[model samples]
Target: MKKQMLLAAMSLAILSAYAGAAPTDKAADVPLKPAAQQTQAAVWASRVLSRYHYKATPLDDAMSEKIFDRYFKSLDAEKLFFVQADLDKYADAKQKLDDAIVGENLQLPFNIYNLYQQRFAERIAYARELLKSKPDFTLDESYQYDREKAEWPKDETEVKDLWRKRVKNDWLRLKLAGKDDKAIRDMLDKRYANYMSRSRKLNNEDVFQIFMNAYAMSIEPHTNYLGPRASEQFDIQMRLSLEGIGAVLQTREDYTVIREVVAGSPAGMSGKIKVGDRIMGVGQGSTGPFTDVLGWRIDDVVALIRGPKDSTVRLQMLPADAGPDGKPVTIALVRKKISMEEQSAKKTIMEVRDGTVKRRVGVISLPTFYMDFEARRKGEKDFKSATRDVARLLAELKKEKVDNVLIDLRNNGGGSLTEAVELTGLFIDRGPVVQQRSAEGKVEVENDTVPGLAWDGPVGVLINRGSASASEIFAAAMQDYGRGIIIGEPSFGKGTVQTLINLDRFGQGDKARLGELKMTIAQFFRINGGTTQLRGVTPDIKLPTIADAENFGESSYDNALPYTVIKPAVYIPAGEVKDIVPLLEKKHQARVAKDKDFQYLVDDINYVKKQRKENMISLNETARRKERDQQEARAKLREARLAAAPSPDDPILVPDPKEGLKQAVSPKPASAKAARQAAAVKGASRTDDGLQGDERSLAAELEAEKAAKNAKDVLLNEAVHILADEVGLLKTDTRLASRVLPYTSDR
Candidate 1:
């Protein structure tokens, strides 16, 4: 009997594994008719669920057919990337799915669905039987998934831990409301049954969502099909704050690792919890050995973390990266709600200089393109969003008389499409900002309908691999229109539009349950005809930041679409750089050769790449200690070269992070603070133009005397050399100096 039970368990496990999903493409062998395709898709969906031993949905084979009929028929061939062969294959697959759904000779559909249905019914019956007996279980009340106060279920002893927590918590709530345990349990059980039954009938979405996300990848990363449950989860991810321990977990090899802890959150406030921490165990409250959960799925782990806001839940975190001690780290944190506003966007100022020329550049650091979608859906147009804040900032900058601006869109994942269009229009005079194409072969241009341009001065856009979607769109359009200069590394490649559609709406009484898929509906293109989907925009003057090619780049993504260009639209270039390209190139080479920052950046990149390449790396103490030593060595080297500000007694040093004051000073931070970083246009128009021997010689003699007085030491000498070269551009045409400089003083 024992051996028989073991064998049966193994067989059931195997069946459940297949239930998760029959290979993603099960219709490959059989061609599907359009109607049949719906049935096949439904059947395939059922098979996927049954393999996982999950419950069945209300959706049936007939319902599946109707959903596919609307869905597949809606496909715009012109919008798809399918070639002749691909289209033919797609058709065949659809036909096969339809045939399967139509109750044809399909082998897996009926059996898998029926088997899972029975399995679900058995679980429910068991629960019903427990209720019938009314065993002396705890009168517990807790919200397992719905609320934030739920606790983690420790072991097999707590498989129905959620039930225990929910019942206990619900009972308390009812008792607080003057109800008895009998009445409370009855109500709570009713609610539980209702929720589970509805969820079990989620054939359209819940069980097969990962595959739906797979479909979103068919267009771009941003296009996603979110199951209802997944949709709720995605909302939390977007806000960057979860009502949990505040630790970000990711799949590394086979184990889930703590990516980073949100500072000031309950987990982060512990100080002991750090980035790269691995969570091997979790304790429900605080009394016993932590429960081992090394092989749990990411979603399961997430469910474990979230609890009622302000409720206490201890976490057992393993040390992340080794520190000075070169040993393992163990940390405990009490879960708490995270609500730190400090990390959000704010305005800052940067002063640039070129000799005596000074300029103040306004910088707005937007953390993310965020929107309160819920409020907006409630018809609140005045709800807080990025565009309003930015518009206000631009107005403020104008009041300060700031001409140049740098909008830092780095690390900005796109939010609302409305904002992208509105923000892009803020730059150029009224016109189309981007072109959108739909799966229905429909093309439309999203225009900036605003009355006037916000700013007409020089704009420099900085982006990196983290800048994606709306960021890419704005950058590409700005670049195409010759409205701004792009600076920094390439952006993240993601430029697709997604839409949410409910799958369960097709029919009533279906046995299958499924959710919405965020599928790609269209691809966006610059008005000038280039898609920012896979190949992000190229910057005019690339700066060396940590986000350069090595640390984060487009090469990291899977199934990234190819970069291609279409016919260009007639649009004016942002700036006339007739001779600027060669000039900028020359300047770049000079800076690259001498800039310590650039050199340091190169070394850092090489080191990172080396670490990434090495395999079979050890995580033992010896290797860890060596890494710490290497890091210390780097810190020491950096400290030695750090630019320091002069004391009150010494005025020679300039306080500037980007300005290498020690290496070269006089173009003080204050002087060139506002000067654009572009290569200065050269000319033979000298300030000291031709004058009689008396005037010219007098001016020269006076200039020499003043130069001597100003030239105190090394920094001054270097500054003098640079300024002289730039200011004396026309001096070589020595005579032109006479024509230009004579009126300088009088003017």
Candidate 2:
């Protein structure tokens, strides 16, 4: 489901301006249908939204105006492309957009898009012309990179000046990085060309998706229109089973970047690919010639890499920080199905000693609430699931006789709502887990009927802003029941539900394939009556975190559902820890007040905030170089101080000894045959390509060893201390223990 969700939003990448050598008069006749002629799919999409959207916004003049404004903003958020005149010229279409959508007329949007393309082309030509001459870097000026709130350029001349400064800054940055003039120009030329060529390839479907999405998103931020390709990709991702290299790919500049490698998958286990590595080329099998993928469409690259099970895909990649002169490295991986093991619940036991007494706290880190729905439907006895895995892990922890359990849900973005409810059942007896309110104001209570409790011991659930939807449901449920103490940062507030509606399903036989609509149809609320919409579940024990609510939470989204409360559900409260919270908080405050790592984190966050406030960097070459040098010197000083200081005793403050080793070494395989096959592929590829595999392996291992020494986690260590404190208090304080355990009457 995570993968499907990724693909659904893949096509939403901003189409950045791509400058190239001046073209012959703005390619005026680039083919496109007039905007007034709406496709059957467009009409079907509009109808679907009106009937099924959670926020039933009317497709009227007011909505049309909003969509018009949003669509243009989406095209040029930075205000670099279109001028005020362009918007003014298209002003009449603002009110007519509502009529066009209802009347199944798309001519207005298409016309707007056509005008945008023309201006985009002209700007690219102008930018390319400016790049022909060297830029003046001696001027003491600042370039405002963020322009979301800035007004549009007043005229073509103003936009040209902005581009000139932008190009100059780009050139200066490369020059400061020690690149030769020729190298800088070559790289810039290629990047610009790639941008232009890619933009030129945008067909009607791309325009339609962009426009329709603006409309749907005006209704609610999560609601979107995915084109045919994006829809298919989303479906494949939802299966959570794919025969591919298991790397998330995105296009940045001219290179196809590896955004992430799924843990326990072929790419991840290979230890050859890294996040941000640029794939220069791809090959199939042993003998296939590597095809240069520069300027290629992202989907094209994705299709080339994704193949049948047991097949081989070889990636020629440049390291993330590589310069223009950097050489590409070859990595061969045997493509296989990325299984649930990568994202399943993982358990670790941490020992915290209070003076003479020692306690073992079990930590279960669940990345996402997931279940193989198709596999379960097929009657597979051991279909991998979050609830099932957590249940097994809980039993294991109990067997180990741990005093308390901490469920680390940090960075969990959520999946499968049903699994969230079932997983919540593991900690407590069945009851209403969450409430759902549909578009028609119909409320439904989702209950967990399972009677058995997995771990009724003292529990702590850790969360952060990355935790959303299903994560919030479980956290809020536990907090309400007094089943556990909530810790860490407040969660991501995403309370609404999205249902994927396949437009193809609505069409008759032989209809042109319309994409899918991820329409928001309902909002979820906690059993305690509050919705984790704009305001998510607040932790009882707050930790130092970099997540700012205004910038990072659901409130960041323009159309997110507001925080609201509903009638509380009838349920029994297990107990409350209002009395114990202050003590825990005091201990946390005292520990972090002087702790070196915590203080350092606080300083770093403040520095980042300061940098954000002072957003503009000096465009002058001398000033920029001096600033860079100062930063480097400070970084070196900090590094030396850390090296001279004694290592912290807590694992959270101290680096993980095996952390770097995990990344360097191949992940432990699920099957011996799979491991052997991977080994065989690596050996065969090395021999076929005449590569020095041993030398590379040794270098990677040595680097990993060095990095592993520096990987620290103060957050986890602090969480352990908090839990240990809870255990100690529960044992010594009768009142605290009484609130946590079953009441005397129930017993």
On TM-score, the leading prediction is: 2
Candidate 1, residues 1-747, lDDT tens digits: the string is: 000000000000110011122111112122222223233344443443223211112234443434333232222111111123322334434334334534534332333233334434444444544554333324222233222112222332453443444333434444444556576567656654643443243342332343333333333334444444554553442333345676656644334566555666666677777655666666666565665656554555566556666655556555655432344444545556554232234454444444455455666666455445555667776655667778887887787765356677655655556667778777876777877765454567878878766765556676655666777778888777766557666776666655444446543446433444444456677888888766677776665433324323344444444565555555545443222333444555574567554465456655644543452233233443455557657756655654443222221323334433332211111011011110010001112121212222333544744553343322212222222222233234444333323222133
Residue 434 accuracy (lDDT) in model 2: 90
Could you tell me every candidate's TM-score relative to the true structure? 0.49, 0.80
What is the alpha-carbon lDDT for the whole of candidate 2? Answer: 0.72
lDDT of the candidates, in the order given? 0.46, 0.72
Clashes of 1: 77
RMSD of 1: 23.3
Q: Which parts of model 2 are misplaced by more than 4 Å?
A: 1-29, 32-38, 103-107, 180-183, 245-295, 304-336, 510-512, 641-646, 652-710, 743-747
lDDT of 2 by residue, 61-135 (tens): 888888998999988888999999999998888899877766776777888888888887887777777767888
Deviation from native of the Cα of residue 612 in model 1, angstroms: 3.2
